[model samples]
Target: MAVRTQVKFYYDVLSPYAWFGFEALCRYQKPWDLDLQLRPINLGKIKKESGNISPGPCADVFKGSLFFPDVQRTSEMMELPYKPLKDFEESVFIKGSLPTQKTLAACQILYPDNMEELTRQSWLGLYSHDMDMTDKGNILQFAEAAQIPDVDKLLEFSVGNEAKQQLISNTTEALESKCFGAPWFMVTNPKTGRREKFFGQDRVEMLGWVLGKEYVGHHPSQ
Candidate 1:
């Protein structure tokens, strides 16, 4: 039997590209013999720790102009859903996806088995349903949608030091891996004991090379 490659997928719902990476990697997991670990990190904290204070796309005219259309194109290519909000204020800038990320960290701590579902619900809440993520009620609904047990406890823990610091720790780890963006992958080839890292959503083909698999493209059967 071939050894399973252990992969840590670091993400924040703040980036739609991370969503694409998450979805694509999950699709490749079974065929590629991967043990995918979902680590929901805080992107804002990652940037801050890395001394990266670059302005968002909305702050740049040409980048902002091409943003949503590019998002649509990528979403279509990847067969993913992405309904962007009318403005950045209600979206990524809505507390910088802080509350959602912390809640995801809580999900990781309490229900490691359900982290992916919780993460997906969080991303869909922001990018699909257009929920007001800053509101506790709306954020709670994400867990509910994910079928998380003890959601009240989940929300309670989300504000606690354990979740907050764990998220900070995850952010620190990502930066330590020299990650500059979301969907950063830390891959451990179990057989060779080699540690490798890759960035961006469009990196599955490269990852296939690392894992000794042919690139079948994202959701080829879709």
Candidate 2:
């Protein structure tokens, strides 16, 4: 059997750039035969280890400022929606509980239907709706909007022992991957145990290039 190439994404809910990368991953799915491994870890922890400040405040501003013209250009090039982040500042605030719960909750929804949408919705809750994804009420509200019922139940799972353990496992795996940043992807060769790392959505096409696949370019405006 040909060995399947694994693509691991290390992301945090607080990053608009990470959200952008998630969409890129969704686009790359079929062409690369990617086996995506989602690794969700606290970007705060990663920043602490790397001795860096949180990119949330500055990055949100930059994204919001550059978002419009970029959106216009990209929307013209591609069919995806291009809602600028000009008024999306309030949504950048990351409260621990809500974003954590919503991230896992979206995972619960998409792990069954489509992991891509799950990742996309988690970001949408934060970036698009301008909602605080860390609050239970907000998360529940977004869940309902996403057509995921039983917000109470999913929140329960988000805090359950199993979920906690898995989160820890995912964190450990990310550290082991020798990465400490948002929008990171790593592929481990099952046979050689060799790992390849790509940081930022801009490098995603490089991921395809590394795996011996053709690169479908992202929108030029990005």
Candidate 3:
């Protein structure tokens, strides 16, 4: 019997990069025979602890200006939707830990088969439609949109000690694993017992390579 490979995806909804990365993984998981795992992380806490600022707000004005354009280019390359939330820096920053907690709660309640859809809906709601995920009402709204059968149960679960601790533990584990950003991947091939870490959606090809899949380099026209 062949041992299946496992790919653990660490993400935060606050990042557009994470949204792209999540979609990329979903596209490749079936083809690669990967046991995909989604783990919620708090990128804000990770950045604060690591003394790193997001590129969009970095002191280098030129670098800061390039961040959104780079995101647009990557989104186009991946053939995924990209949209900037109005007042993102000001409004979304006030959302605190709610988004992460909500994701953690959803993961606990939803089956693994449905996780990807839930992730997509949440990401689109926040990044594309500018839904305020930090708001409890918006959380339930998005949950229902994602086809979660019990939105109220999900909301109730999100506020429990178990859900909070799970998010905290996942975030702590991510930091311990040297994850400094969202969309980080920890790939483990059980057959060969190989483990590697990958960052960014652009590295999906490299991840495929690690899984023994042929690397098809990006073609802009594709």
The most accurate candidate by lDDT is 1
Clashing pairs in 1: none
Error of 1 at 193 (Å): 1.3
Q: Evaluate model 3: give its lDDT.
A: 0.74
Q: Could you give candidate 1's per-residue lDDT for residues 1-222 as a string of tens digits?
A: 767889999998888889999998888888887899998888877776777643457657777788778888999898777887767665676567888888989988998987888888888887888776678998888899889989999999999999999898888889888887787999998868999899888998998897678888877445
Candidate number with greatest TM-score: 1
Candidate structures ordered by lDDT, highest first: 1, 3, 2
Question: How close is every model to the real structure, measured as TM-score?
Answer: 0.93, 0.75, 0.89
Write model 3 residue lDDT over 113-173, tens digit each, in one string: 5567777887877777787777777776667777876767777777777777777787788
In candidate 3, stretches whose alpha carbon ends up further than 4 angstroms from where it belongs are 109-111, 216-222
Pairs of residues at least 3 apart in sequence or in different chains that clash in candidate 3: none
Candidate 1 vs candidate 3, TM-score winner: 1
Candidate 2 per-residue C-alpha lDDT over 101-175 given as tens digits, one digit per residue, 9 for 90 to 100:
335634544343434554566667655555566677766665565555455666667766666666666666777
The superposed Cα distance between candidate 3 and the true structure at residue 47, in angstroms, equals 1.0
